[model samples]
Structure formats: C-alpha cells, structure tokens
Target chain A: MNISAKQGERFAHAGLALLLLGLLPLALGPYWLNLVGKYLAFSFVAVGIVLAWGYCGILSLGQGVFFGFGGYAMAMFLKLEASAPELPDFMVWSSVEKLPFWWEPYSSLTVTIASIFLVPIPVAFIFAYAIFRKRVSGVYFAIVTIALSMTLVVLNIGQQGETGGANGITDFSTLLGFDIINDAGKVAIYWVEVVLLLTATTLAALLLHSRFGKLLIAVRDREDRVRFSGFDTAMIKAFIFTVSAVLSSVGGAMFALQAGLVTPSLIGAVTSVELVIYAAVGGRLSVVGAVIGALLVGFMKSYLSEHFPEIWLFFLGGMFIFVVWVLPNGLADLFRKILRVKA
Target chain B: MTFRRGNQAPRRKAVIPAAISIEETFVTFGIFVMQLFNGLSLFTILLLMALGLAIVFGLMGVINMAHGEIMAMGAYTTYLTASFIEHHLPGLMGVYLFIAILLAFAVTFAFGYVLERGFIRWFYHRPLDTLLATWGLSLILQQTYRSVFGAQEVSVPLTTWLSGAWEPTETIQLPLNRIFIVALTILVTLGVWYILHKTRWGLRARAVTQNRAMSSAVGIDTNRVDALIFALGSGLAGIAGSVFTMVGSTNPGTGQLYIVDSFIVVVFGGVASLLGTAASSFLIAQMQTALEYLMSGSMAKVAILLLVITVLYFRPNGLFASKVRA
Candidate 1:
C-alpha cells in the first residue's frame, strides 16, 4: 500500500514546519539554536534514509561518506578563506608546502557547493548501480556500504597532510569573509540551515508523492515484478540512492557551517549506521518524522551522554531493539496509531 | 596509495656494496618471509572470524552484527580462564591455554544458543532488521564488557612455550605465538569442515540451508539447526578470540576492529562458499601485508578497502559464488 499520510496528516506536517522554522528559534538562545542546527544537519541524512530505506528499499549504511564529502568540501573552501595566502595549519604541520590539487577546486564557494553533490553523487550512483544491477539487495548492500564508509574513513585519516588526519579539518573562523564562529553568525547560519531543511523536506515529500515515489515503493516491495513490468529497477535504485546522497551532502555542508568542524569520525562506519537509526526511530516512511527523530534522538543523546555517560550507550542500544521490535515504523507510526484511536 | 619516499631506501641501498649485495638480498628475503608470515597469521585470524560469520549468514541469512562482541566474549573468557587457572590450578600452567580455548568455546557457544533463542531467531527473515538488532546487541555487549572489565585492555599471560621466536635460518625468525595461532586456525578450519560435512547435524544444517520448507517438511527441525549453526559459528569466533590473546591484547572494543574486516572476508569469499571465505581472507591478508610494507598502516588499509570495493563491483557475488537458481 502507498503509506504516505492521508488528508488529516497535512495539518500535522504544517504544524511541524511552523514549529521548526518560526516558533522554536525564538525560544532557544544561540547555543541551543546552533545545537538544533546541528541536529537539522543530521535531519537531512535522516530524511534521505527515510526515502532510500523507508521507501526505495535501498538501505545505505554509508550516508556518512556523502555527508563527509559535503562537509569536507565546504570545510576546504572555508579553510582556504580562513588561511588566505598561507597553507592550512594541519598541512603546515605535515610539511605540505604546496596546495594539493583537489584542494584547489574547493577554494571557490561555487565549486565547493557544487562539489558537495558532484563528488558524492557519482560515487554513490556507481556503487549503488553495480550492486543493484547484480541484484544485491538487503544485507549485502548494507555490508558493502559499511565497507565503503570504513574505506573512506581510512583514506581520509591516511591523507594527514590534506584531510587533516585524525584531528580533521577545523579551526576555520570565517565563511566568505563572514565571521561564522560568533553568536550572530551562528544564529544566522541556524536560520539558513532551518530554511534549507524545510526546503529539503518539501522536496523529499514532493518526490515521495510523485509517480517516481510509487515506483520506488514498488521497487522496494517487489523488485522482480517492477522489472517484469519493463522498469529498470537498478536505475531506479541508483537514482534514489544518488538523491539521498545529495541530501546527506547538503546536510554535511550545513553541519560544517554550523558545527565549525568536520572529522574522520563523521564518515566512519559507526556514524553511518547511527544515521540509519535516526530515520528508523523517527519513522523511516515519514520525512518530517525522520527530522523529528533526528532532533529528538540528537537531543536525547546529548542530554543522556552528558548526564549519564554509562547509561547512554545502553539506552541507545536498547532503543534500537525497541524500535525494531515494537515500533518498526518509528514514533510517527505510533502517533498515527494514537490519532487513529482518537478518530 | 599516496606516493611517499620513506620505504624506497632499502632497495636503493641494495646498489651500495658488492659483497653487501648478497647480505642485502638475504635481508630483503628475510623481510619478505617475515611479512609473509605476518600475512599468514593475519589470514588465520581473519579466517577464524569470517568462518563463524559466513556459516551463520550462509545458513540462516541472518547478519549478526554482534559477531565481534561474541569474539570479544571469547577473548574475555580466555582472560577469566587464565585468571581462574592461575588461582586454583597453578600446576596446569602450560595446559591452561588449551583449557582456556575449550572453555571460551563452551561459554560463547552457550551464549550464542541463548542469543539465538532470545534475540536472533526473531529477525531471521528480516535481514536488515537482524543487522540493526544485532548491532544494538553488539553495543550492549560492548558496554557490558566495559562495565565488567573496567574499559582497559586486558591480556592473558603468554605461557613460556608460547613466547620467543623460531629461527629456521640466519636471517629469518618466526614468532612462536603466530605459528601456534596458525596451527590452531587450521585445526579449527578442519574441525568446522568435518562438522559441517561429516556429521549428522551438518547434514541437517545443510538441508535447512538449501531448503528450509523442505527440510522442515522432512522433520529436520530447522529452528534447532539455526540455533546449532549459530552456536557453532559463535564458538568458532571464541576460539579465534582465544588464539587472538597470543597475538594482541583484548579490550572491550577489539571486536569492532574485526567485525567489518570479517564481514569483508565473508562477502569477498562469496556468501555460500566456505572455501571462498578462506581464500578471500588469505587474499586480503596478503594484499594488506604487502601494502603495509610499501605504505603507512592506514594507507594500506585504505588501499585494501578500495581494492575490495573495486573487485566487488566486478564480482558482486564474490570470488567463489556458488551457482544457484535465482
């Protein structure tokens, strides 16, 4: 069945949109606003996860690679701007006297923004296409993506001179000559991030409601049937995977802008898998729910980790099992059930 | 893969002295032999880890993310076994290693049996969910280890016989521990092969793997097969962990390191083929060893990963895919 919400759910979507863009920012200060913005960055990946895993039957455990592509791409541009007429400090430490060839394209904001999607999309498409074409779905796809993430992490960390090694590329203070590390800058970036998130959510929702969305769900449920109907199931999977990669890429860029750093840890297998749970816990089928899931889980993670560090992993792990066993569709489905009961 | 100038010094120095060239060649050969041995030891570990993973995945189509934790459980069992033996049975020092291996297998096998009943069986057909659920299980297990073991790296004391190196030639010295690990791995591999191929349980497990419905119809007790196969796989990982103590220290996080690599070995070797797992592990271990000789450790890992991914793109079913009706 087509699982998108019916007419009554439209109001709930609007309410969520309004709460995120208009109401919530006014309530939180710069620090919390920045934190929320960070969560919003993850929401991009979560939304992508909802689309890919929730709808398209494509479960990528390596969205962090795309996120890293975007984050590192943006970070490179900002780093160049911050370290104008001199090499980035990490490069200097590693004795890299010359600017790396790849780093050159990232000097311009236009190229950097483009590279975020440009870099990860092709990589994601090729990876997804090859596997999906071979009819490798389910756990094999997930495992391959996990390997990709692991590879990316190692590559990034190994290139100490260029990618800043384990410490990652950080300490940049400005973006396009704008002092982004300040409170006003943080608030401004947070607002932009929220707007971008809203735009992404709208785009994803529209896509999900489209003919392609139907095909995506069709491919998810019964690929052989879809292929029998003369649809290129592999192409469909690759397309959705690329779209999700783009979403994650943008989120990574936004994350770098808001959080002021990007690390190898972001693109590692652990973080990539963790990204799936956000969509999962939020209700993978619901775009808005994934965002809510990102925020809710992100907030819980910060709060729980800060107060009860020992219990945090237990809680997170338990939540994964609980979500899979009890709320397979996540909190959004739970809300839908509650609403249905009332009606 | 990044070009560096550090490792080229030895080859360049080979041009130096007329008589020294012979010694240099001998030294180079020694290094090659040493690296080869290192690769073999690595292959042994990877094979042990991947065998358990491959068996479980091949049979039941369940992806156990907690496979590594199960390995760590084995490692931890070895530690505990060693401590217990030292306290109660000091006279059984040399034989303690053997006892620890058996104990580790028993502990983890029982753990896996309970785990299959309580947790894993629920997500049998749901492979993705199984992956996520087991990941959650892994996290909990890791946390439990940290809580019990206090988060520091723990090691079993190497028996007197396990330490030191065997010198077969003037230039070549092989660590005795690695040789022991290699021997243990071979025995484990043979045991697994024999159990799966020669035993009645193996016949039933294979029957279930090939056709669960048919096997069930024939009264094979598919559920019991799944539980047994899972336990056997886990117990193998425990043996891996036990031998792992000889090579490296065990920590709460050691399992995480091997999990992805083990999965790679399983996938690269073709899912259903046991021989494929062994072959892929050897290929990967050798490639990694060679690369590490030429580049930095991290770079070698990256190169190996890239190579695996590239090879996978070409042969998605892996190198030794079993031909089956789709």
Candidate 2:
C-alpha cells in the first residue's frame, strides 16, 4: 500500500478507538466514571508530553506547572463561588480576612477558563523562546524544565493563604452552577471529560497530519539540518511547546472541575515525571497510545494502592525499569508489531 | 585583634559612602553585612549540593533528577546516626556530628554506586530516559524512606559547640551552625578541586567527561569512571544533607526543597566547571537570601527564578560553561 493509504487506515482505526472511548462512561459505574475522568485528565497531559518531548525532543519535566496553573484557576473560581456567603474554610482558619489580588480574577468562570489556556501558553512561549534560542537542548533542557517545576511547587507551598499551601485548594462546592457533590453533576462532568478527551485526541491527530506537523517531525529528527535548510527550528519548537502547555492547562482545569480541588502535588516534579512516564509507556509516537497508557496506569494506581499501598511504588518502579529495558519504543509499538504480524 | 585594627579602620571608612548621611550609611551597611553573611551561609549548603550534581551532570550529561533523593538519603542517614548516638552513646553525641556526616556520605555514595551500576549506566547517553528512570528511582527511594522513618520530620540533635550563636550585637546574632556550614563548604570545595585537578583518577575522569569515545579508545574504563563520578556526586549531596539537618528539619520529602535551587546553581554556575558551580551558588544564594529578607519567601523565590531565567536568556551555556560543542 502507498503512504496515503496507510495514513487513511490509521485514521479509520483512530475513529473507531475514539468511538469506543466515548461510550466508556455509559458502561462504567459512577466510581469507575470518576476514575476514568481522572484518567482522561492525565491522558491529556501525556499527549502534551508527546508533543513537547516526543515530537520536539524537548524533555520538559514541568508540564505539571501548566497543569497546576489550570487546576488552580478553576479551583479558585469554584472556591469563590462555594464560599460566597463566607470565606473559604481554610482561608478563614488561616486568618486571611480577604482574598489575595491574584485570586480575585479567578472568581469568574470565563476568566478562569481563559486563564487555563492563556497562562500556560505565555509560560511555554517565553521559556521555549529563551531556551531554544540559545540552542539549549538535550540534558540542559530537561534540567531547566525540572528546575521550573521545582520553583513552582515551592512558590505554591509558600503562598499558604492563596494556594492553601501543602493542603492545596480543596472543599469546592460547585462548578458551573451545578452542585459538584451531586451524583448527577459527577456523571455530567465525567461525560464532559470523555468528550473533551476524544475531541483533544482527534484534534491532535489532525494537527499531527498537517504540513506543519511534518515540519515539526523534521525539526525533531534533524534540527541543525532543518536550520541549514532555511527553517526556523526555534519558532517551530516554541509553537508546539505553547500548544502542549495549553492542552496540559486544559487538562488541569478539567481535573479541578471534576475532583473539586487543586494542590501543590498537582504541579510538583513527581507529577511532571509521572506525565512523562505515561507518554513513554503508552507510546510517544501515537496520541492514542498516550490515552491508553494513562488509563492503564491510572487504573493500576487505584487498584494497587487499595490492595497493597506499601508495595505499589515498588511495582511501579519495577514496571518502569521493565518498560525501559524491554519496550523502549513503548507499548503502542508492541501493539503495532502484533497487528502487523496478524495482518 | 592585631589584624582587626588594620581592617577595622578601613572598614569604618568603607562603611561611609561619602554621599549618604550617617543613619542611612549605617543602616545600609548593616543590612549589607547581614545579607552577605546570610548569603554565604546559604551558599555553603547550595554549593555542597550543586558541586556533586555538577560533576555527574557535567561529565555524563545524565540529568539525575534523583540527586535530591540522594540528598534525602544522606539526611536520613544523619537522622539515624543521631538517633543511634542518643540511644547508645549519649556522652559521645557531641562528636557524633562528624561521624554522621561521614556515614551519610558513605551510605549515599554506596546507594548511588548501586543505582549507577544497576540502572543509570544503561541510560548513559540518553539523558531523557535517565531522567524518567531516575525519577522512578526517586519515588521508590522516597516511599522506602517514608516507610522506614515514618512521614514526620526527624530532628538531628545539634552538638553544644554548634548550637549557639555569636552575638555581634543585640539585634544581630549569627548561628554557629551557619558558620560551620560555610567553613565546611570551603573545605569540601578545596577537596573537590584537589581531586578533579590534581589526582590521576581526576585526570582520567576529566578525560572521559571531555571525550567519552576517545577516552574509552585510549583504554580508560569509562563505565567505572561513570560510576565513581556518580558516587562522588551523590556523596557530596549526602554531606549537604548532613549539614542541612543541623539547620533545618529533615523529612521524607525535604529533598524536594533543595532540588530546584541546586539545579539552578549548577546550571547558572555552568554545568562542567566546579569553580563555576561554587561561584554561581554564592551569587544565587546571596541574591535569594537578600531578596527573602526584603520580600516574602514566595516572592523572593519567584524573583530569584526569574533572575535565573534572565541569566539563562543572556548566557544559555551558563555563567561558566565550557566552550565545547556537542
């Protein structure tokens, strides 16, 4: 078959996969639906990692920063709406008489949503421009992003009044005029999350098939060669990085909306590294792989923690080591090989 | 006192900036001196952490995100040692600080060596993979420590000699621990300089770091060099952890606090040069301490990070980066 035919086949397969994903919420119980919702949020971040790290070769260990930004944005709004008659319980207990200046703007849903997309884009853009312009790639790039994540976690924790510090922003009462605690609202949020996940995956697929996407892959594979060929590699990297950051922020916002809380844990280095693991395990080359990897790991996390909390991390560590050793190309490639053999 | 007289008169004159009033001069001079000492003490800890990180990261290009975890390991070792001293050797608890520091370095170095042999060595040139792998390692280590030590902060009992402060004035008392850290940092830096610049092993290590392929072809065991370098780097982090226990609370996740700042210092100092790391540590620490004194902690951290970003923007290779290309 020709290249175009192969591409056509992949799209058909992707559509079928997404159709099954769209029906998952309908089949699962409320508890399972909530788990699935968290999985979707995590998958979005994995997709972002695929773009920044897999496609652009920019190992950004700070996707959590953008993710937390979105989560906090939504959390602030929810907290404001929930505490309309009085101060947030934590803030009140902590002796904060009024909201800080930064928290004031997040009270509006529109502003919160806008910020979910806006905040990460600017951060990614500025960081990418500064680092990429200097030709700082490889380990240096990874270190810088990791440092950024660390700084963010500390900054969040230090701002105890606004951020809720280590306890984080929790006890949200409502989201989008719906009582967040209600079962119907939870189900509604779950379905919305599923739809968003599918939409995001489809959009990512379409984008990756575009001309710019081809250029992006080229830049990743042979950056210097592309630069010599008259392409501005830095701009390409910056653009993709901004897109990834925006997507992660959206994921974070949705996560807060579903879970009704945001914490420093969301933006910490560990969480950022977890996102990378999701992408790596699922298949950095495929967006579908990202979703699959996230859902699988998320489910495993829930199950293992409940059954054997102490050994769960050890299992994860073993799995990571196994994955790196055996399936360096990720699980998606393994599946691809199986399908190829069957065909 | 004889040396103080010559310096005291010059320092008194130096304090007067000629353009400022006496009160303004005194206040500014006082703050400057305070901030300088604060910065130096802060730099002491940062330098200890970054020096080791700089070696491993600079030489191998493996960004060990778990460097902080290793530091935590060191802190935990100190905590355990202090507990042992308290329980068994009560009279010897005062001198236990030295033993704790040494034991922390040894234990963490061994752990680092095993980690390198078992996991890190495989991901030698692949910095990205090393990052993920080490991160997983950090999580495992952190969870293990949590289970072993419990989640609460463990205090390291300070020796009497290192417990008190030097009261320069009623308003300005300097902690002895801080002074000890500064002195320890200088000694450690000098020791590292001696190792990296003077010794035969250091020459081979530098040779491998500069050109891995060529060094290997020239019959140098690059794998052994890699492991030793990692062990040494992590050992420095261990000493840092030991020093930290004297000044702050040691917890399962206390490593997280220093990880970013250490990375900033390492990168800002220039990845490959020990001197660069030390200089950058001093500069960044002083900047952060002064800013913290002036602003809120969060604001100061943000400002320092922003300053780092600005510095990176101007000099991407860092302040003391080698001119070699990849």
Candidate 3:
C-alpha cells in the first residue's frame, strides 16, 4: 500500500482502538483508570518522539528534559495552589521566606500553560540552533542532548530548596480549584488527559501529513539535496525540535497533574533514553507505532512494578533487547508482517 | 588608521611595562603553577575514563552509555577485594592492591566481552539503539548493585603507601592518590600507544576500525577484533573505576557523575583520536578546575561548556578529528 492509504487504514484501526480505550474507564476500577491515565501521558511523549525522531530523523535522547520542564512548571503551580496562607510544604521545611522570582509566574494557570509550551520550545530552539547550526548530526547530536538532560538534572538536584531535589515536587491538594484527592476529581483528570491525548495525536497526525512534514522527511533523507534546494536544514530541524519540545512539555504537564508530583528523574538521561526506546520499539516509521509502544511499555511498567518490582528492570531490559534483536522495526512492523503472512 | 597605528605603538610599549610589576608577575606565575597541577590531577581521572570511551565510541562507533557502569563495577570489585583482604589476609592487604586492580580489570573485561558478544555485536551500526540498550543495561546494573551492595557508599581501603600527602610547603600538599593516578595514567597511555602502534592485534584492530569490509577481505577476523577492542576499552574503564575509589565514594549511582563529562571530552577531543582525546581532556579539565577555583562549581561548568561550544562552532570537526567518514 502507498503511504497515505496505509495511514488511512491505520487511522481507522486507531479510531476503533481509542473508542474501546475510552470505554475502559467505565468498566474498570480506579486503579486501572489511573494506569490508563499514565499510559495517556506516555502516549503524549511518544507522539512528540514521532515528530522529532520518527519523522525528522533526529534521534533526541533527551525528551525527558522537556517532560521535566512541563512537569516542573505545572508542579510549581500546583504547589502554589496547595499552599494556603503559608508557603508550600517543601519550601516551609527548607525555610524559604517568599516565593522565588522564577516561581512567581507559575501561580497563574495562563502563565503555567503558556510556559508549558514556551519554556521547552525556547530551550529546544536555542539548543538545536547551537547544535544543528554547527551541523552536529547523528550520535554527536544525541550526546549533546543527553548532556543537556544531565545538566538539567544536576541543576535541579543542586537547587534543592527550589526544586525539592530528588524528592521532586509533590503533595498537591488541588488542581484548578478541584480537590484532587476526591474520586470524582480523579475521574475528571483522567477524562481531561484522554481528551488531551486524542487532541495531541490528531494535531501531530495533521502536522506530519502536511507539506512541511514532507520537507522535514526530505531533509532527513537527503540533507545535501535539501540544502541545494535553498532550504536551511538547520532551521527546519530546529522547528521540528521546538515542536517536539512543546508536545513533550504538554505531556509532562499532564503527567505531573496525574501523578501529582514532578522530580529530577522525569528529566534525567534515563527517562530521555526511555522515550527513544518507546519510539524505536513502537515503530519509528509510523505514529500509531509510537502510541502502541508507549501503551505497552507503560502498562508493563505499572503492572510489573506492582507485582514484581525486583524483576521489573530485568524485564524492561529483556524487552529492549528483544525489540532490537528480534523485531528491529518494532511491534508495529511485527504486526504488519504477521498480517502480510496471513494474507 | 595610519595615524592611530603610529600612536598606539608607544601606548602598547608603556602598557607592557605597567602590566608587569615584579610582585604581580610572581603572583601570576604562582597561579599558573597551581592551575597546571590541578589540571594534571583532573586530567589523570578524565584520561582514565576517556581512553576507554574513545576506544568503544571512536573505533566501533558504539556509544556505550554504560561505560561508566563498567567503571562502577571496577570500583565495587576493588571495594570487595579490599574487604576480603581486610578479613582474611590481614597483613597482606597492602600486597593485594595490585591483585585487586588486576581482578577488577579482569572481571569488567569479561563482563564487557559477554555484553559485546551477546548484545552489542548486533547493534554495531545503530549508535542510537546501542545508547538506549546500554542505558537500559546501566539501570538494571545500578538497581542490581543497589540491592546487593545495600545503596550506601562503600569505601575502598587504600594501602599505607597510597595514603597521605606530599608536601612542598606548609600550605601546599598534594595527595598520594592524585600522584598515583597520574603515574597510572602515564603507564596506561604508554601501554595503549604500544599496543595500537606496535602489535599485530593492534594493526588488525586499526584496520577494522578504518574499514571493516577491507579488513575482512584481507583475512582479519573483524568480529574478534571488535570484541577484544570493546573488552579492552571496558577493562580500561574498570581500572579508572578502581583508581576512582581512592579519591571518592563508591555507590550504585556514582557512574552518573562522570558519564556526561566523559562524553563531552570524547566529543571535544574529536571522536576516534586518542591524542585528541588526551589533549581535549587535559584542556577541559584544566579550564574547569581553574575556573572552579576562581569561581563557583556551577559557573565553572557553564563557562567550560561555553568554551566547548565556541570551539566546536569554529572547528566543527573538533580539535583533532580524523579525516575518515563518520
């Protein structure tokens, strides 16, 4: 099948899958709903990876930096909201007098949401400009981003009073005036996440199908040709990187809202690498593959950690090796191959 | 322009004399000496780590994110050996330092070989995948070590000769460990140079690194070369880890601290060049340490990274990049 036709057929399948997933909360318990919520957040990150890595051929190993940025942004706001007449719990414990200058803007939801997109975009733009402008492609680019993520983690850890360090940002009482502790609030948050996930997926799909997306792909495949055609490859890469960062930030924000905490672990090198794993294991050639990969990995993580925490990492490692060795194109390709065989 | 140039020569001549008071010159010289030694000590540790990373990343184009983990493994090995010596050997603890380092190297080398043969061999062309796979491996290794080693920092007991300091003055005292690392680094560098330039195995390795297909056509076992080179690189990391235990604390997650710095050194040194790697390592370490002494640690890091960025901006191929295709 041609690319568009394949996309159309996959879209139909995805629509059916999402319809079933939306109905899952009604049939399942709160624990399962929360699990699905986690998957949705991961799916958001996966979508970002599809744009940055899958379509653009930029293998960014530090999506976690943006994820952490968004999470920290939302967490800061939530922390402010939870703080009644007094400062937030961590700040109080740390003996901070007034809210720091950087924390001031996050008090407003408008600012937080704006920053959810703005912060990571600028960071991505500046970093991408610095790196891509120098024509640092392939593994060198990956290393630079990995270093950036590590720097963020170290900065976060060092700023213990502001960031809560390894403990991260937690202990949220409310989000947008709704008591998060209540069951109804939890369900509401879950539904909000579901809506956001679908919106992000649709937007990403539309963007990828656009002319700009084709150019991005062309740049990935033949950089010299694209440059000869008078298009600046670095600018295009920076744009895609910025878009990916914004989407990752949105995912991070939703994740912080769902988990009610944000930590350095969210933005660490490990998490960034995990994002790439999801994209690779899901099938980097297609958007749906990323979503499936995220869902499967997230599901496995939640269930396996709960049941057998000790062996969870081992299972994760085994899955990575399995995906790379046995199914290099990821689970999506495996499914396609099986379908082809049956046909 | 001609008039200004003529006028500026006398001003420049006057400024030179004004800039160089005897006490000021002496102070500047003192600072230079201090920074040079600081740079050397920092270079020792960085060279130990970067040498291993350079071989794996440069030769095979495999970004072993878990190189630091291998170093951690070496440190843990040293710690365990020290413990064993403390319990059983008693008086033989000092004598066991050499044995402990050798054992550390052997254990990590074996681990590296198994990892390459089992996992890394398949992902030779896929740098990004190797990164993710190795990162996953690092996590599992870290968690496993945490479970086994009990998460707290383990101290490696140094021999009596490896302890204390060398004093040139009342205020100037250099630790024995730093001197030991410097000596070890020199020996390791010489050993590596000899192997790469002198031996038949090294020739095969170099041939394979340059062109895998051509080397195979010439009857070289490229696969064995890859495995051995990887093992050797990992063994070097293990030695670095063992050396690190003398100056710092060892924990499951200690590897995280050096991984970023090592990568930066590798990149800035021009990936695949040992001489470049060593030069860049010294340059970055000296600049960073000097800046740290002059300013704050974070600020120094920021400054060093900026310097790297500027250097890379001007010379995208790095300071000493090979003329081979990436």
| Residue-by-residue lDDT tens digits, candidate 3, B55-170 | 99888899898898899999999999999989988988877778888999999999999989998998876777787778778878887888899789999777898789887654
User: Which order, best to worst by lDDT?
Assistant: 1, 2, 3
How many steric clashes does model 3 contain?
A: 0
DockQ of 3: 0.41
i-RMSD values for every candidate model: 1.2, 1.8, 2.0
* Model 1, docking class: medium
Q: Model 2: chain B TM-score vs. truth? A: 0.90
The TM-scores, chain A only, for the candidates as listed are 0.96, 0.93, 0.93
What docking grade applies to model 2?
medium
Q: Write the per-residue lDDT of candidate 1 for residues B137-215, one digit (tens) a residue.
A: 8999999999999889999999999789999988899988888888888888988999999999999998988988899
The true-versus-predicted C-alpha distance at residue A245 of model 3, in Å, is: 0.7
TM-score for all models, in order of appearance: 0.96, 0.88, 0.89
User: How well does candidate 2 score on lDDT at residue B116?
Assistant: 89
Locate the minimum summed-lDDT window of 10 residues in model 3 chain A: A1-10
Which candidate number maximizes DockQ? Answer: 1
Q: How does residue A289 of candidate 3 score in lDDT?
A: 77
Window of ten residues with lowest summed lDDT in model 3 chain B: B1-10
Clashing pairs in 2: none
Report the lDDT of model 2 for residue B59. 79
